[model samples]
Target chain A: MELDFSIEGGDFTQAGQASSRVKKVLKQLGVDAKCIKSIVIALYEAEVNVVAHAYKGQIHIQIDKDKIQTLITDEGPGIPDIAMAMTEGFSTASKKVREMGFGAGMGLPNIKKNTDELKIDSVVGQSTTVSMVNYF
Target chain B: MKVSEIIDQLGLKVIAGEKGLDREISGAYVSDLLSDVMGNAREGQIWITLQVHQNVMAIASLKDLAAVILVKDLEANANTIQHSNEEQIPILSSSLSTFDIAGKLHALLADK
Candidate 1:
């Protein structure tokens, strides 16, 4: 099965909607509890990155018999330094965003730690795409 | 311990998600940073923090936390309450600071 979701930038009000929906689907499909948690965390952090930095984004999810894959593509201020952004404590979030307790620079790392595979593609001044997979 | 028991013992105010008062708790994690909680907090743990936002509920739901205790009399936003209700994860409020709440919760869970 496949699912699609759209995320809006700077919209903290609905930040977790996509992740929440995906979680429900996973639960109904009888995915393992532990695997569901990891998938949810990774998907959520990816969703938040779009809401926090992108202009807008689309999330594509594919659920197979053995694994789940997600690709989050966002049109935004593309990350200039993917390596730096992956660092645990480096962030480019605005002051207002930081005050909300996000932008702690832990999003990507958390995603990487939870997911079995992670790939990030970005071009400065254009967009960023994050792909992640978690095996059931 | 159960969430309701914690409320009675700690004098916590149920701000929202009262339906989850019976949820079982196994541990406690204290952090104001959302990602830190996402990365480290375990299932069935009560999160004690000063963060009073909607994303707190998001993390609690995604991580399957027992409940959330907002310290120092902090209150959650409207959206946060809505999500809490939807997710059925209690959002408790405490007049005590984070340190005080964490200590009490730690001692309680330790005894368990």
Candidate 2:
């Protein structure tokens, strides 16, 4: 199965919609509870990242018998230092974003911990793409 | 224990999603950070925080949380209450601070 979703920057109200839908689909497919939890967590963090930082983004998901794959691409101020951004407690979010209890710099780390494979590509002034996969 | 039991014991005011008052509560997590709650909170746990935005409801629904407790008498945004009602996950209120409410909730759950 395949799925796609669009994410709008600064739209905090709609941030987790994709994650919630994917979760329901995974549940109906009889995915293991642990696997579903990890997938949902990673996808949600990535979705929120787009809403928080990017100008706009798209998410593509592919589910096969053995694994689930996700690609999140965003157009915005891409990460200048992916390594630094992955570190805990590092963030560049504005004051307003921080006041809403986000931008704590745990987003990427959480995605990494929950996914079996993860890749991040960015063009500092243009766009970023995050690809992640988890085996069933 | 059920959500209604905690509401009765803690004197939490039900702000919305009264339909979920019978939902089961496995535990409680106290945090104002959205990502922290998302990364560490487990399913069936009641979230206690001061965040009043609709994003809080988004996280609560995605996490399959039992309910949300807004501490310090903070009122949720209009859209937040709307989402709570839509998802059927109760939005509860308490005048107590996060620290006080968390402590009380901890004691209450420990006895269960």
* Native interface contact recovery, all models: 0.76, 0.94
Q: Write the per-residue lDDT of candidate 2 for residues B1-112, one digit (tens) a residue.
A: 9999998889999999999888999899989889999999989999999999999999999888999999989999999999999999999999999999999999999987
lDDT of 1 by residue, B1-112 (tens): 7999988889899999999999999889989889899888999999998888899998899889999999988879998999999999999999998888888888887887
Instruction: Please give the range of 10 consecutive residues that has the lowest summed lDDT in model 2 chain A.
Output: A10-19
Error of 1 at A117 (Å): 1.7
DockQ of each: 0.80, 0.91
Tens-place lDDT digits, model 2, residues A1-136: 9999999999987789899999999999999999999999899999989999999999999999999999999999999999999999899998999999999988899999999999999999899999999998
Provide the lowest-lDDT 10-residue window in model 1 chain B.
B103-112
Q: List the residue pairs that clash in candidate 2.
A: none
Off-target runs (Cα >4 Å) in candidate 2 are none
